[model samples]
Target: MRLSTRYLVPLIALFACSSPTTSTPAINSSAGPAGTSVSSPSSLPELAADPREPFLAKAVASLLSEDHLLQRKIDDQVSREAFPKYLEQLDGGKLFLLKEHVAALEADIDHLDDQIEAGDLVLARRGAALLAKRREVVAKVVADVLSKPFDFTKAETLETDAEKRTYAATEDELRDRWRAVLKLQVLERVEQLEELSDALAKKKPTDEDAPARPPEEIPPTFEGKEAKARKELAVRFETRFTRWKDMEPLEPAEMFLNAVASVYDPHTQYLAPAEKENFDIQISGTLEGIGAALGEEDHFIVVRELIPGGASWQQGKLEAGDLILAVAQQGEQPVDITDMPIDKVVKLIRGPKDTTVTLTVKKPDGRVETISIKRDVIKIEASYARGAVLNLGKGHEPMGYIYLPGFYGDTRGASKAPERNATDDVRKLLEVFQKRKLNGVIIDLRGNGGGLLGHARDITGLFIETGPVVQAHAADKKVEVLEDTDPGVAYNGQVVVMVDRFSASASEILAGALQDYQRAIIVGTGPTHGKGTVQALVDLDKLRANPQAASAADSLGVLKLTIQQYFRVDGESTQWRGVVPDVVLPDPASYVDSGERSLFHSIPWSSIAPQPYKVSKHSWTAAQLAEASKKRIDSQPVFKKVEAFSKALKARRDDTVVDLKRDDWVAERKRNKAELDTLDPKLSETKPRVEVTPLEESAAEKTAPKTAGDKNVKKRIDKWREELGRDPWVEESLLVLEDMKKLK
Candidate 1:
């Protein structure tokens, strides 16, 4: 609950197009008052259609200009940069807009800043209208192109990278581009079907667990497969178009405002009301809803996964893969949701706690049924900390492993103290490990992107005595050192903090602090994700200066603004260049072009005066442990295959042009699969190197299920343990821990 009201550290980034402002001004009428009228492009409609839009635009501009960390002005240069980004947001694939349409849209690009300042979104409207028109045209083109059979023998290539291509010159050229795209999609689907068919044919009757393909379900020939692919593509396109057309008015506004906000930095974004709600859920790891994660599949809102203890899970009838056809409040008519946007569908299904909502669903086997369930608080268990004991054969000492997906805390809790949080959970796990007398602990933060910043500092304090955890540099050049004043340590044992390229923000803070204090050895494939800045959600409704705008304040949404950049206690900012781990592992994921450095307009890495802090006493040095690890890793066959696969993957990523010819495409896919098959099986099918079991007390709770929801929870935990037992990274860490004990 520390510094809960201060700032939020999130893992997201943006470009500068504006002149620097000499001074930061308070939110006022510098951009003009609400409902301000100014000259705009003659072709575009007036802003009076949506009275709230002008006020929203003015508020966002004022906030960005006055409070953004960059303090950049909204000017012509920013407009020039933001316009193209806005265009990209509309059609990043470059599939819909023609060259002429793009030219027309770019006509007033330079004047977008002026339009925004005056509360007239002429360019945004034009771009949105053009995109709508292009989508209608593209839909027809897709239908026409798919109506005819493709010439599979014709040799051709398609540039899959949109950045490498330009807008089509004419309608014919656009149609031709669509033809290539459709052809490629159909080709991939046909090849996939063929591969599945081959696998099924090769499967022996003795293979009882193998999935059985009904005789009617299998496409007998290549022609039949191709036909099936085409039909699927048609349905997919129709669904996609319907979804796009159904987008709310505020969505386009959000995109334009985000483009403007991103000009200052990547993390600054204008979140629509719905997006703000989703972000809150992500940080808190809880929501009031049906508890089913939904995804779109050819127009159907298919339930992807059911959250354990959620309303859907408790209901028992609703399940993963079930199609939600309609939703209704209790005693109300069910509203058909075919081809509806996922967000809208979610909104309908999510309601107040104890409220009964009904769902009309189509089961996987095609049975239709109506289900009613009372909504409840759904806690996302995956986001919390989980612990397991690792038994490494007979010679090595048992070690404890804690997997923290994020630094989650209850956002709705009181600012001074949270009822439940990650720090408390991790502390409990550490206490359990302390009692067991575990030799070493592994804090697995592999894919943790970060959440609440307070938890990061408090979690770091759990491993060390009181000290400065991180330094925050605000926009006004003021520095605030966030320290752990808690005088005692939670667990002062040998520790290894596991990270990866995706470990970001709060993750970086904890890892960097631990590494700086020499309290833990860092282990990862590469540097952590370099997101050093902190963002805070500012409700635009509160910043309305004009009394006229107050009536519409509720719909104004929120702006996630970057307000501070944090640095490690060692003085180095983990902005672009993240914390370097002590022991670097050979991982194929390392080959990915990721992290903050890969992002555009990310803040550069810098250093501040290092804070005075005592380093914890450690018996073994990182170099000694790393040297021993490298020897074993080099000779490991799995790692060798990983190295080769990494190279192949890098090569594959570099080659953006794909062959459209059926035979050539199939051959390319085969070659790619052959390369992957070498390493994929080794990574997934390796025998468990260590025995992973739950904590003694939690074992009963995990295995003994009292309800259907608890049964699902048990299955997930067992699967997690099984996967962890087979993980090479975890195995490597166990070996490293043994080295730490012996090398001393």
Candidate 2:
């Protein structure tokens, strides 16, 4: 829980955005009342007709702002060393309030923009002041977040009016108790700077070689040396803050509105008009670009996957694993877009059809090259599919593995019954597993970015007999329990749920429920994503159409706000802590930064009422799980090799930059490869040729399954089977399940 200045700060930078280009408007109005008091939606700015897109856009923009971006960068530099304590002081309730404020502000901006576009300057200025007021609120909250110290005594948080009063009182008490913690951090840093100066001031060589005192034990002196050291430390903070201030300025209303929406949940956000339109276009499969999905990877703009028929893929020069280093339009110089936000990069990359864009790509092998491609529509078929299975190693021990990448179904078509959704797909997989008499089932929820909430609950029901799956807390502090109501327990024998850093939101809920019930063994990287919050899609357009503020763009318009927080049965928060695994595994993803700690304005870990149920003790306790993992780590050569590889990578991460000397870089890489080859020779082999066995019908049970054709249902099923068969994580999960069996 101790914060480290050196290792913690840079990682957070990955999530924070640069500063704004324009000056934020100052608030002349008196500040809103500080204590817990909910403002009526009618009293806020108008929401747009389709607000989710705008909210998402604006949220992304705000997250990329200078203050947030710098903080995240610093966090990453420290590799989560300081995060626990850093998150402790955050106000969960205030977080919701802030997000609501942001959403309202975004609505105002959206309205003013609409008015301006329609030649209404009078309305635009009115929107302008609301923007100013919103900024003031945001600035204060940001300051508060940085200044506050965490209180461990506030165990249960308020989600209702009475609870808020109690919660506020508890926080006040804890805040007073822990105020010294913040002061101590500053005192400690200053002490370190002073000690270093003292060492320098000593003239004797032997004295210089003397052991330095730990940061805390050094006494504060009144000498000029102490004064100089303090001044130097101040310079450091100034430099860090200046780096934050250099980024782009968000339009006044945008920052205020998005910050408000974020308080509800990390995912709920305000979108600028441009960002909203682009996201819609992307969802409709109409984006013109290289045809790849992108997201923040540490501080880099990484390509998540490629559309098979997209311009980038068709050219075949670019692969799914390549990282985009820079992007340049036809007439502009190539901009070094490394560490830039995904949406901004997307904006730069996307354009009209046939427009040429040049990209600098970096391969996993460290080879760098440039490619020029024309923009075009690309279908993203690989992101989601059906028929994934769990393999019990090479023997096909009949453990079903299903990968639900996202809860996806085209809800657009009128005749499309939503019943044929992710849950349905899973039910079919279960049926197949049951018929095959599978020994157990492994659900690979790893890398699922989340989608429909209903699908997630239904999916949990497939494994658990029945129970309350998750509890959601809204603005009024009312708790709504989402239950797993399905009576059918399909292939419930020996379930193992595999999750990693990217398994989030709905995925976290499902994993948490299964773990809470001991219905499944949760195994994977250290923790699942800590996104235990919900979002309400507010329509800013609708708000603007109201007569009360018809001309007040600032008052009547924008935001998709987050209005709730969620809790697990144990009353432990998943906001920043995430769900810890029963058995931990090594993953390449651990080498890169991801998850809640990597995001800006993420809600701090807090808890609510526990579900009226108890977790069944795991067949093996935490100690036993750890011992078994140790045995496996020592016995399995592959595991050891991966660990060693990680250590070497971490050493590299310790370096700030790399030399581009071709021969030297090549030699170093060669040496590293040789070392890796010795550890796990299989890693050097070509990508494994994954041959999926076609669904077999025993000659004894010759029943032909019904097929729905032209809909591509059968084809989709086959493709899913192929993907599941090839999944390495699924294979790894089966290994862990076998380990669990032995330990039991």
TM-scores for the candidates: 0.78, 0.56
Q: Summarize candidate 2's per-residue lDDT along 451-498 as a digit string, tens digits.
A: 778877888888766678888775456788888776677665677888
- Lowest-lDDT window of 10 residues in candidate 1? 13-22
After superposition, the stretches of candidate 2 with alpha carbons farther than 4 Å from their true spots are 1-269, 279-291, 295-323, 327-358, 362-381, 388-396, 413-419, 537-557, 614-626, 658-729, 739-744
> In order, how many clashes per candidate?
4, 79
Give the root-mean-square deviation of each candidate in angstroms: 9.5, 18.5
Best by TM-score: 1
Superposed model 1: Cα runs more than 4 Å off: 1-49, 192-228, 273-383, 410-420, 545-554, 698-708, 711-714
lDDT of 1 by residue, 1-744 (tens): 112232233222101111122121111112222212222334322222245678888878877887777777899999988887787776777888777667666778888788888887766665665566567778988998898788999999999778889988777888899999899878866765776577667786556323234435658988888888888678767877776765445665677887777677877878765465455444443335877666655446777556555777666778765788777776564566766756678789888987888887875433355677888766455445788999878877799999987787777536665444788888888988888888789999987878889999999999988999999987677889999999878786789999988789999999999999999999999999899998777665555555235432245666787878999999999998998999999866644666888765677788889999999886889889899999999988878877887777677777889898888877876777776676553654778888998763352124222443443556567767878888888899988888886755
What TM-score does candidate 1 get on C-alpha atoms?
Answer: 0.78
